[model samples]
Target: MQSLQDALYNWLTIKVVCDVRPDDKAAVETRDFFEEILTAQHSVSNIETTKDDLMYYISYQQGEEIKKRRYPRELIEIMINQINQEPEKYKDYPID
Candidate 1:
């Protein structure tokens, strides 16, 4: 069975790639971008970095349970830029 992480990844990929008629896709993208940034930032601080295995020291484990990852500030900034460049993408979309 696929883990929540895998499912989320699939969802993200679908959300980013698909151009459906829904007005909420943009919001999802923006939210996802911000989430990625935050996760990266937290990950860098709380987790120790190693030259050998990048994902070896990961503290969060996933299985039947859900796990949140660390987002990076740079990622958030990038998403912000995306939103800024395309203002209409995520405008007035309902927050999930």
Candidate 2:
């Protein structure tokens, strides 16, 4: 049997769905914008627009056990800004 660490080393897939109309340009742009930001660290499989929502599928190799949670766009922007302003503080951020 594989050890827990080994299992986690394998790529893990995650999917996030946003409730946005397929034809809304603003929503599409927002989703695409964030997708670019996230893809810097993870692999984005695909971003799809279904009738009711936009679906984002991504995968990344787990560096350490991270608590699964959802981050809003504003929060993400804030975190990025903080990291940029104080690189040393977040140089080892997320404590993987």
Top candidate (lDDT): 1
| Candidate 1 minimal-lDDT segment of 10 residues | 49-58
Estimate, for each residue in 1-96, the C-alpha lDDT of model 2 and write its tens digit.
Answer: 434322222221111111322343443454565555444444333333222223222233334433232233443244345545776764331212
Candidates in order have lDDT scores of: 0.40, 0.35
lDDT of 1 by residue, 1-96 (tens): 444344344333333323232356555675366445435533212322122222211233233443444333343235445655787864645535
- Compared with the true structure, model 1 gives a TM-score of 0.26
